[model samples]
Target: MKRRGPFANRRLARFCHEEAGSILVLWIASLVAILGMTALVFDIGRVQIAHGDLQRFADDVALAAAAELDGRSDSITRATNAASKLISNPQAYGGDGTLSGATDYTLTFLDGLPAADTTDPSGYTTTDPIDATLVQVVTTPVTLDPMFLRATRTLAGVTGPAQATVFAESIAGFSMEACDITPLMFCKPTGWSATQASSIGDGILLRSGGQGAAWGPGDFGFLDVSSSAIGSSCFGLNGAKLIGCLIGAEDNVTGCYAQRGVTIEPGQKVGLENAVFNTRFDQFRGVMSQFKSNANYTVAPNIISGLVPQGNACGWNNVSASTNSIGLPHDNCFATGGCTRFGTGSWDYANYVDSNYGNRNGILEAGEDSHLVSHIPAAFAGTRYGVYLAEIAYAQTAGLPSGAILSDRDETGIAQCSSNVSTNPARRVVIAAAIDCTKHPINGAATNVPVDEFVELFMTEPVGTGVGSPPSFDLWVEVIGSAGVAGLGAAGTGGVFRDVIQLYR
Candidate 1:
C-alpha cells in the first residue's frame, strides 16, 4: 500500500512498452496459422488418396460382377459373388481388412450397357439378370480420418470431431460387333439350355488326343467358313460336303459374319486357304496364338512362336511333287472317301480312296472341281486333305503334343486345372465368334446363318503329333457372348465399346 519505487515503475513501463518480444510473438502466431493450413492440406491429400482407392475398388467390383452377365443361369449369383469377393477382399496396397460386402453395393443389370460415348453413366436401363449384358456396382460411403486436419484443428482448439467419408462407383460391360472380329461363325441352337453356354465358358471343352466325337463342346471341328472368301469357288473346300459334312454341319448354319450382311450360301463351299488365314498365320505367326486388334482393325503379329511353321510345312509338303502323294491330297481325297483308314492300313501305304489301304470314316469326295484341283494332283491332294482331316479328328479325340499352350502351363510339362482333364495345364485362352454345336438354326430363315456366340477356347495342343504331323489346333470351349432370345443381332461396337474389364463413370 506504500509508494512504489521509481525502478519498479520503470521496469513495469519497460515490460509493457517493449517491442523487442513482439516480433517473436508475431512469428509464433504466423507459424501456427501456416502449420494449421499445412496440416489441413495433408489431411485433404490423404482423404483424396483414399477416395481414389475407393473409386478403384468400385471399378474393379463393377468389372468383376459384369463379366457374369453372359446369359448364364447363375449370372446373378456369380456376379454377386464376384462383387462380394472384391469388396471383402483385402486392400491392394495396405492389405487392410475389407470395408464392404455384397450388401454394401447396389448392382444393376443392364440390357444395353452405357458406352463410353454416353456422357452420363446412367444411360442404361436395368434388365433382368438372365438378359443382362452389363453390370453396374456402387459402394456405400467409406469413412476415413482427416488425420492431419483433425490433429491441427485440435491443436488450434477450434474444432469438433473431424473425419471424412467417401464413396466410389463404376460401370462395366462387353461388346461383340463385327469390328475387329475374327472371320468365323458358329450356330447357337434355337433350343439350348443355359447350361450349354456355361459349358463352353467353362474352358478347354475339346482337346487333341483327349476325346473323340464324344469328348467336349463340339466333337468335330465344324466351324462355319467365312462367306467372304477370296476366290469364287471353294478353293480348299472348307465348306464342302466332303470336308464340312465330315466335320459336321447344322441345317441353317453358315459360318459368316452376319452383322456384315454376308450370309453363307447353301452348299457354298469356301476354302480355308484365304489371304486372311495366311496373313494371320504365316505372316503374323498367329496359329494357335493370341492377337490384339490394331487401329486398322487387323490383328497384330504373334509375340511368341506358334504353330504356323508346322502348318506351313504341312501345306508345302502336300503341294510339292518331290513329296509325292504322301502329303495332303488336293481335291480327290475329299471327293471320294478312299484314303488310308486306320483299321485297314499299316505304318505306310497309299490308303485314301475306297479304303484301298485302310478302313476309316472317310468323306466321299464329291468329284474334283477343276478350279479346286489346281494346288496338286489327286495323290498329293488326297494325302494333304487326308492328313489334315485325320489330324483334326484325332486332335479332338487325342490332344497332340502341345506347344501352343503358353509357357506358364509349361506346355505339357505338368497337370492343369480343368474339371475335364487331369494332365497338361492350359496357359492361354482364345475368344472366337462361332456357332454353338448344341444349337440348331431356325428353319427356313436363311441358307447360311451368321455367328450367334463368342466362344471361349483354351488351346490344348498345336495340331500335330510328334514331328511328322501338321499344325492343327484342339480346343476346350464354352459360349461367352450371346444373342439373347432374339438370336444374333448386335453385341457392341466391334469390341471397342466393351472391355473385358473397364472403369466407367
Candidate 2:
C-alpha cells in the first residue's frame, strides 16, 4: 500500500528473524536441565553417604554389646547396658554430627542361628539375653533435605520435597579359640557358674624358692604350652605327661604340697602347690599382684582381702613352715589331691588365714613381695594380665549348652609342657590383649575372670627355655567378651584352642 524499498523491508524482516538470539534461548534451557540433574544428584549422594555412616555405627554397638555376653548370670543385663551406653553417650564415638546419637541407635540380642546370616562355620546361636552370643544394631531412619535439589526450584522452576530417609544396620558376636597360651595353669578348682560351689574353682598360688613351688617330673602341674608353636596334646592328657618329663625332678627341686600329700617319688606325676580360696578361682591375679613388679628387687604388698597371710620365714609369727591341712582334702585317692570327685577340693587354707592354724605353712607366707617378674604389667594397658589353664578337657555336646554342667571334671594333660595347648572347654584359659602397653590395673567386674566369660590376656614375657628354670608367665587380663560352644566335646583336661569373635551381617 505504501511506496517503500523492497531491499530495506527484506533487511528488517531478516533482523526480526535473526538466529543469534536462538542460541541464548537454547543456552538458558540447557542451564535449567543441567541444574535439575545436579540437584537430584546432590540428594541421592548425600543420602548414600549418610547410609554408610549408619552401617559403621551399627557394627560398633553390636561389638560393644557382645563383649558383655560372658554366658554367665546377669550377662544379658551387662551386655544391654554396655551397648546402650556406647550408643547414647556422645563421647563414645563422635557425636550426632558424625554418627547418629545413641538415642537414634538401637540394638537387639539374638540367640541361635538366624535365617539371614550364614557366616559362621559352626553357626553358634545367640538365643537368650542371659546367654546371648550375637547382637544386632540398627540406626533410626535419618531424614535429609536435598539442598541443591530444593534450591534449583528458584532457577529451574521445578520442585519436589527433595528429602530422603536413610538408615543402616549390622550384627556382631563373640567367641573364643585357643591362641598363644602358657602351659602353666594356676589350677582353678572351681568352674564358672554362680551355683557351682565345690566345682567352681580356686585360684592357685605359686611361690618362688619355696620348698614346693618349682616344677618337677612326676609333678603333673608343669605344662609345655608356652612355646611359639604349641605341641600340647590335641586328643588327650599326653601333653601333661610330656611337660612333666620336660621339667623332671632335678634333685628334689620342691613341687609337692603336704596337704595333697604330693610325695613326688622317682617317677610319679606331681601335683600343684595349693589354692588360697577353697574352690572359687576368684581374683587370683589381684591377689597375686602383690607378687608382680618391674624393679629388679622391688616388692609389692601381697594383699588377700579376706585372709591375713602369715610368714614364719619372714618372722610374722604364724609358726613353722609346715603344710596347712585346714582346707585341703585328706583322702588318698589318686595321690596328692586324688579326690573321689573331680574338680571338687576341700580347701582349708581359710582356717590358717583365720588364725585357726598356728602356722601358715601351705598358704603363702608374707614377707617382702618376692615377685620374680622383670616387667610390671598393667603398668600400661592394664588389661593384659592373664594365666594359663594347666589342663583342659570337655565332653561332646550338640546345642549350645547352658551353665557349667561339669565344672572341674577329671582333666588330664597336667604338667605336659608341649601338650599344654588349651583344648578343653572344661579347662578354660582366660586370654587377654593389651589395650595399651602400660597402665596400672584396678579391680572390678571388667577385669575379673567371671564364669563363662571370654577374656583377653596379654603375655608380657615370652617363655624361657624349659631346660633352665621352668618358664613362667607374666600376663595382664581383661574380660572383653563371652562365649557359647558348638562343636566342642565334653571337656578333657582343660581344652584350649584358637577362638574368634565375628560379625554375621
lDDT of candidate 2 over 231-344, digit per residue (tens): 322213233333332222111111211110111111112332121111112111222222222121111111111222243112212222223222222123324555322222
Q: Each prediction's Cα lDDT score?
A: 0.39, 0.35
Best by lDDT: 1
Q: Each model's TM-score?
A: 0.42, 0.41
Number of clashes in model 1? 61
lDDT of 1 by residue, 1-505 (tens): 7999999999999999998988999999999889878887877776677667767777778878866655556777888887787554444222254546766568877666435654554556655664566677777776777777777777779768886877777778643334323333333334432225333222222322111222223322333344533222223444332232222111112233432123432211233111223222222222211211211112111212222222343242222222111222222332344431111112122333312212323433444222223433333233222232233333343444542212222112211211122121111223344444343332211343334445433322222221212222333232323322222334432221232444545
RMSD of each: 17.2, 18.5
Model 1 lDDT at residue 61: 81
